[model samples]
Target: MDSIPNQQHAWVNLRRGEPAEALEYRADWPVSKNLEPGEALVKVHAAALNPAGYKLMKFLPNFVANRPLGDQVFGWVRSDHMRLTNQGALCQYAKVREDWIAYAPSNIPLDEVAGFAIVGITAHDMTVKNADLQAGQRIFVNGGSTSVGAIAIQIAKSRGVHVTASASAKNEAFVRRQGADEFVDYTTVSLPEFLWQRAEEGRKFDYIFEMAGVTDPSMYTQSDSYLSPMGFYATVGPQPKGLYLSEIWNLMKTTLFWHLPRVLGGPKAPFKLVCLDYQREDLEQLQRYISEGAVKPIVDSTYNFKDTLQAYERLMNGKIAGKVIVKVNIEDN
Candidate 1:
C-alpha cells in the first residue's frame, strides 16, 4: 500500500469509567507510521470487538498512572503504560504491525475480518500450543458459545481431536456445528459428575482449555480426573484480585487438593494463568489457517465507523452470538 495521509479518522475515548457514549470520532489523529520493515499500514476495512476491549477501558484508569485517563484513548500507550483509550476495531484506518496483519479469508465476508484475529489467536494458543492437543485426544472447552470457543473447537477438530464443550442449552447446536463431539449444558449438568461419568465410560480427555475463569476451580479438578495422565489446563481470563484470607484459604485448598497431585504424580501437568501476547509468526500461521479453510471467522453484527459506540454497546450486552465488528471505511470498499 501507499503511504497514508498525516491525519486519519479514529474513535477516541474522552474519559474513564463511562459507557460507549463517552467515545468520540476524531478525523485528525495522526495516521500512525509504518516505522519498522515488517510492519504494514492496513487501511482497516473491518475490525472486531472483543470482551477485553470494553473491560480494559472500564479498568484502565486503575491500572495505568499519569497517562490520560478516559475512554478516548487509542492504540498502545507504551508497553507498561498501555491503556484502552479507543482501541476497538471501530475506526476508519489502523496502522498495525506488519506481522499482525493477515489476509482475510475469501470464504468469509470482509466485515467479519476484524472478528478473527484476537479471538482466533487466543483459542489457537490455548489449544494447539498451550494444551499441546494431538490427534485422537479428547479435549474439553469451556464457553463453547463464545467467539473464542467457536474458533477453538474448529482448530481442535481440524487437528483430529475429539471435543467436549460446555455452553448454555441455547448454544448446544451451535457448539456441535462447530465440530464439538460432545456438549454439556453448564446450567443443568454438574460438570464434575458429567466428567466422572465420561471417565467411567473409559473416555478421558488429554487437555482442558479452561476459558471460563476461577468461578469454579473444582470443575478443573473434576476434569483433571478424566485427563490422560499428563494433560494440561490453560486459562485466558483475568485472575481474581484483592487477597482476602478466605480467598487465600480457598486458593490453598484448590491448589493442594486439586492441582498438586496432577502436577506431581501424573505426567507433567501444565497450568497456565497469563495474558496472551501476539507475535508476527502467529499471525502468519493464522492467515494460513484462514486460506486453507481450517478455520472461519464468525461475526454477530457490524456497525459503521460513525456508530462505534453502538458496536461497543452490543458487545457489552453479551447477547451477541458471534464476533461484533465495525466497518471502518465504507468509501474504500
Candidate 2:
C-alpha cells in the first residue's frame, strides 16, 4: 500500500440546524497514516449518505455538529482506524476497522454499492434475522423508497414473503421493480386507512417496517391496528422532524433514537428499533448477497467530493428516490 497523506480533504459540518447550513470542505485536515493492530487504511472511491447530517445532527451536541459526517463508504482497505483514530469515510482516505471492511463486488459498480453498509445491515437484520419473516407472511414497508426500505423490500421478497411498501406516486414503480408486491401512493392516499382497508380485505400485514422517518405517530404509530396479532413493527425511529426542518415541530421535537427490535413497545405489536449491528459474519453475508445479485445498491444521485456540501443540501431537501453519494477524487492519492 502507498504511504498515507499527512493531510487530506474532508467536509466538516459548519452549522447544525439545516444541512444547507452545515458543511464546508477543508483542504488541510490532518489524516493519520499509521495503522494499529486490526486496522486498514482505505482509499475511498465513494461514500453514501445516511440521514446522520441530513436529520440527526440537528439534535446532536455542539461537538458532533462540526465533525465530518458519513457512515457507509465503498473503498479499498489502505490501513485501519483503530483505538484513537476515528477517521470518518467522507475524507479522501478513510481509516476503517479491518473486520468492518467489506470489499465491493467486482461485478457491481462501486458508486451504487457505497450506500449499502449501514442501510443494508439494518434492513437485513430487521427483515430476515430479527423479524424472522416467513415464506407466506405479508409485510408493509412504510417508506419503501428509502435506502434501508429498498433493501428491506428485496430481502423480504427473496425470502418469499409478500411485500407492500409506500413510496411517492413517482417512485411507486421504482419499488415495484425492486420486488414490492403492493405499492401505496402515500402522496395520494391515507396510508393507515389503506392498511386498514387491506386488513378488512383479509390482507393484514405480518410485519410492518417503518422506514418513514416521521414523528407524527398518526402517520404510522397506529399501524398496529392493521397488523396481524403477531406482527413485528420495525423502525429506525421517527423521521427526524421533517428532513428540511420546514415544520416548527419538526425542528423542536426531533431527537436521536432507535427502536429496539424483539422488544415490545407499549403498542400491541412488537416493535424494534433496527440498529446496524453487524459482525464480520454479517458483513460476509452482505458480500455474498451482493455477489449473488440478491441485493442491489440504489444510488439516487452523485456529487463530486468537493461538492459534498451540495450533496448535503440535496439530501436535506428530501423526495429523493434512493441514496445520495459523493465520489472522492483519488487520482492524485
TM-scores for every candidate against the unseen true structure? 0.80, 0.81
Error of 1 at 216 (Å): 1.9
Which of the numbered candidates is closest to the native, going by highest lDDT?
Answer: 2
| Whole-model lDDT, model 1 | 0.64
Q: Mind giving the per-residue lDDT tens digits that candidate 1 earns over 120-184?
A: 77787887667767798998888888888889999999999999999989988888989899899
**What are the lDDT figures for the candidates, one per model?**
0.64, 0.69
Best by TM-score: 2
Model 2 residue 77 CA deviation (Å) reads 13
RMSD of 1: 6.8
Cα distance off (Å), candidate 2, residue 305? 1.2
Which 10-residue window of candidate 2 scores lowest in summed lDDT?
58-67
